[model samples]
Target chain A: MQINLALAQIATKLGDVQSNLEKHLDLIEQAKARKADLLVFPELSLTGYVLQDLVATVAHKPTEDDPVFKHLLKASHDLDLVVGFVDEDSRHRFYIASAYLSGGRTLHVHHKVYLPTYGLFDEGRFFAWGDSVRSFDTRFGRVGMLICEDFWHASPPYLLWLDGADIMLFSSASPGRGLNDKEKLESARWVERVTKAYASMFTSFVAHSNRVGYEDGLLFWGGAVAYDPNGELIAQGPYFEEALTVASLDLNQLRRTRARLPLLRDERTNLVQKELDRILSK
Target chain B: MKIDLSINTNLARTILTAFIKSEITRADYSRAVINLSGGLDSALSLALTVEALGAENVLALRLPYRTSSPDSLEHAQLLVDQFKVRSETIDITPMVDPLFERDPQMSKTRKGNLMARARMIVLYDQSEVFKGLAVGTSNKTEILLGYSTQWGDSASAINPIGDLYKTQVRQLSQALGVPQPIIDKAPSADLWEGQTDEGELGFTYAEVDQLLYLLVDERYSPQECVEAGFDAKFVDVVVKRVRRSQFKRMQPPIAKLSNRTVGYDFLYLRDWGT
Candidate 1:
């Protein structure tokens, strides 16, 4: 099977859901016109990142009654959509989350497992940490979603790969920092290298959507990218600008790459779990 | 242990210009007001602001005290002409003299602070009429070393170059094509006769910038910096200055008495809904 994927690298207005929703709707139409099967937006595409106190103000449930998700769900009837937003739970605790909407219904909602609170990030202070990292089924295939910092760790992607996720969709509102590198922002260079590594190691297609724009002093470098199961660069968007980059992913590459590598088929889960249990118990 | 303070000028230029443009326009202001000191920091900032907002939208002000160096005004004019930015030469002598006159025996340090605050006052007044944001010119070196007066040159609606060290500022200034004279000359607050930043700080910017890079950016300890070939005394002084000036880099700590105090619990980005 082949899938047309759209990376919506957008600049979101901080704490303004209405304006950002309009941007999402416009991008959805553009991606649909380009014959995209799935459109992925950067993390916090609805509620902008760097919202400390405004997290609650912009938080929403994925239910159709919610104002922002309502329009996004309606748009998903045309094509599948992956969007980032602040998710509010029953106790009113918020989590940085991404939802997959297909055929006007929420298919899977992944609350970001990693809340980066260290230097230049304050997500942990405002939002509750997520406790899950599970991939779900779609019409196209079984896929997984991870927010920015979640993919930085090895375990989340490893868990998804073990759970049979053939397509890893990643999103971020990563700020541009460190000008030491000549070719790209240090953050951008690191993210690209890691995503490609995940694609190659897991033998699964990886698509990363990063936002572009400035919020307060943070500048999000929007260089969205995709790698096929063979770990070859398939698509990339421009940096520091809003863009909708579409790439054709040959899902058959998964079978081809796995047949050659056979790394995923080699079973070691029980041994790995035994050691982890022993080490963690200590 | 060697630290590379060099930055990719192209990357820096793209991000910094975008920062100035976005931060200013997001606040509903297309214009920016900068205090042109004829020094490298202000020159680089003005050049960048022009690139971000346009030569027409930037209002460069030459706020000179009577005691300020003549080269200060002349160098400032070079940038004003080079960028063709809108400019005004407002002599802050009259505004600051009243305060200086009240205390004839005031120290030069006190006078410099008064002059800085007075220039900010004029800069802010011009920003109101010109309807632009006041762009700050303080670099990371001076800010970390506590070399600037509080509420003076440090005041701005947004600062694009606050993260760049002095040496890095020169590197960026050269890349941005700021006049050679501005980059070559000794940096100064120009508060009094023959005052220089390095002379007062007791070290060159190049030396301190490297030490600061390790101590701050690389997260090296003072002992680590000393072990990294810096003089022990130099490391101590830089570390002490950075620690002492912590107050200058933060908003005043609010005493928490309620469920959510402004600075304590009510943390929101400055760009929230603006």
Candidate 2:
């Protein structure tokens, strides 16, 4: 099977929910024109990153049949949307979450498990850590979702693979850091290395969508990329610019890679479970 | 691997135009105000400002003291005429001299700081009158060396040229069509007569900028910088100055008695959108 995916590496105005909602509608149309089956946007693509208390201003229950997601719900009839938004619970707790929307409904919402608290990130102050991780069935395959910081940990991807994820979608707002000899951004290199390794290791395709444009002094590097099941970079986006990157994912290759490696079939789930239980018990 | 630190002028032009316009318009200000010093740095900023907000919406103010070089005023006029921006000239000698007169034993360093701060006061007051934000012109090399007055020239609503090093500043200035004479002239803060910036610091900007890129941007250690062809003494001095001036780069530290401190926990600027 073949599916088209578009990475929406777009810039968002901070705390402007109304305009951001409109922007999503417009980009969705552009992706639809490209005949994309799925479109993935960066983390906090709706309200933007580093919002501080302004996160509250844009936080809304996307599941409540609110008007915010009305147009997006209407647009999801033809494709699936993995979008990042500030989610507010009925109890008033906030989470930096990615909502998997298909056929005019939210299939699943994955909150960011790892909230980066140190050095340049203060997300712990504004959001509660998500304690759950699981892969959900989609038209393409069983898919797992991870926000920016959660993908940095080795555990989430491994666990997601164990849960039967054939594809991992990473929504990120990673800031550009340092410079290489070619003047390429350091964070861009780091993202590609980690994503490609995870793809080859688990025999799963990884798609990372990072935002671009400046927020105060922080510049989010757009270099969104997609990797094949064999860990080869299939498509690359530009840096420091808004780009709609489209790539084709082949399911036959996904099967072949897993069949050849059999890394998942060789797993000892019981032993790993016992070890994790022991560690958690302490 | 050696990185080419030169900027892509076309991309720089587009990004800076978008940045200035978006940042200013998002803050509900349609106009921009800048201190035009007739130097390469300010000239580049002024050109970008004109492109972003249009020459009509941009204001160029020349704040000169009695000791300021005549070339400074003349070069500033080149930009004002080149862009056809709204212009003003304010003599700052009258404003800062009263304070300097009271302290007959004041050092040149003290007097420079006072003048730097006095100029900021005039620019800010014009900002209120003109209803525009004060755009900054300091370059990254000066910021890294703490070579600027703390609450003076460094104070601005927005800074466009702060990220570019002195080397990149010269490069961008040339791309932006800055006058060749200004770019080639010896850099100075004009704190006193015949005082050049490199002479006062005892180091050339070209030498320091290359060393700084290796040390800070590439994560090279002082020893690595020396190995990369910078003099050991130069690396040591730059490292010490950067470390010594860390306070100037940050907000004042708030004691963490409570669970949330001002600078640490509640770190948002006051003018956040509602």
Candidate 3:
């Protein structure tokens, strides 16, 4: 089976949910017109990033009664959607999360596990850390989702791979930073390298989308991209601009790539679990 | 222990241009006002503002005091002519000399600060009338060294070149086609006739920039910088300057008497709702 993926690299207004939702709906219509099977938006698509005090104001539950997700869920009845937002639990704790919606229902929600506190990020002070990393069944295949800093660490994607996720969706509102003689933003170069490495190592299709435009002084570089299971670049969007790039993924390539290089086949999870248990017990 | 400060000029130019455009547009303003000092930093900043918000949109004001170098005005004109930006030459001597005359025994530093603040007053006034943002021209080296006046030349709505070091600023000014003389000339506060930045600071920009790159960007300790082959005395001076000037780089702290003070817990981005 083949799946068409749309990378919605968009700029979000700071602390504005209504405007961002309207933009999402407009993009969903365009993605549907392009016949995309799944449209993935950058992290905090509904509520913009850098929400220091406004995180509580914009946080919403991914329920049918929620103002933002209701429209998104209705839109997803026609096409699968992965949208990032501030998720508030019943206890009123907010977490940076992404939800996968299909067939007018929410399939899964992944809270961003790593809240970067150092340097320009203040996520640790604003939101709760998530402790879950699991994959869920989609109409096409088992899919896993992770927000910006979650994919930077190897464990989240590794857990998803072990949970039989054939497709990994990553989204970020990553700022354009670190300029050197390499003629590319260091952040952009580093992200592409890591995503491609994940696709080849895990033998899973990877699609990553980043937002564009500026908030305060930070500029988000938009360069949505995808890699096949063979670690080949399948599609790329423009940098420093808003775009909705579509790529056709031939899921059969996963079988071919795994057959050629059987790293996943020769794994020893039991030995790894025993080693971790010993290290922790000590 | 050698540091490579070389950057991709093309990438820097593209990013800085986008920064000016996005920041100005975010504030719902389509124009920018720059006090072009006829120096390398302001020349480069004007070029970027022109590129970002067209030549006609940027208003370049050449604010000169009575003793300001004639070459400064000419150098500033070169950029105004090169970029075809709208310009106004305002003599700040009238506004600033009253204070200088009030205190005949005033120090050169005091005079320089007064002049800087005077220019800022005009720039901001024009910002309201022209409905543009005041773009800053301070570089990282000066900012880190506390070589700038607090709330004077350092004041700005948004700064595109604040992160670049002085060495990086020269590199970018060349790439952006700022006149060669401006980039090569000795930097000065021009408070006195022969006031060169290096002469006052007692070290060359190239020498301090390397140490600063290690200290600030690479997060090297003063001891580590000495280990990395920098002079201990020079490291002490730079580190102390950076430490002493900490108050200049940050907003004034608010007293935390309530649950959510403005700067402490009531955290919000500058572009909070816009």
Share of real interface contacts recovered by each model?
A: 0.79, 0.10, 0.88
Candidate 2: lDDT of A106?
86
How far off is each candidate at the interface, as Cα RMSD in Å? Answer: 1.2, 4.0, 1.0
Worst 10 residues of 1 chain A by lDDT: A177-186
Which regions of candidate 1 are displaced past 4 Å? none
**Over 4 Å off in model 2, which ranges?**
A65-75, A88-93, A179-183, A200-203, A230-238, A255-282, B1-17, B81-86, B97-106, B210-247, B250-265, B269-271
Candidate 1 similarity to native, TM-score: 0.98
lDDT of candidate 3 over B103-220, digit per residue (tens): 8999988999999999999999999988999999999999999999888899999999999999999999899989899999999877678889999999999999999999888899
lDDT string, candidate 2, A1-282, tens digits: 999999999888778878878888888999999999999999988888888978777887666377787767777888999889999888888999999889988888999999999877889988988888899998888999999889999999998999989999999999875532334656777888899999988888999999987787667888889999899988999988899999899889987887888878898889999999999999
- Which residue pairs clash within candidate 1? none
Can you give the TM-score per candidate against the true fold?
0.98, 0.83, 0.99
Residues A1-282, candidate 1, lDDT per residue (tens digit)? 889999999999999999999999999999989999999999999989999889888988998998788888899999999999999999998999999999999999999999999998888898899999998999999999999999999999999999989999999999988778478878898999999999998999999999999998899999999999888999999999999999999989988898999989895999999999999999
Pull out the clashing pairs in model 2. Answer: none
lDDT for residue A207 in candidate 2, whole number 0-100: 93
Worst lDDT run of 10 residues, candidate 2 chain A, spans A177-186
Model 3 steric clash pairs:
none
Task: Score each candidate by Cα lDDT.
Answer: 0.93, 0.86, 0.92
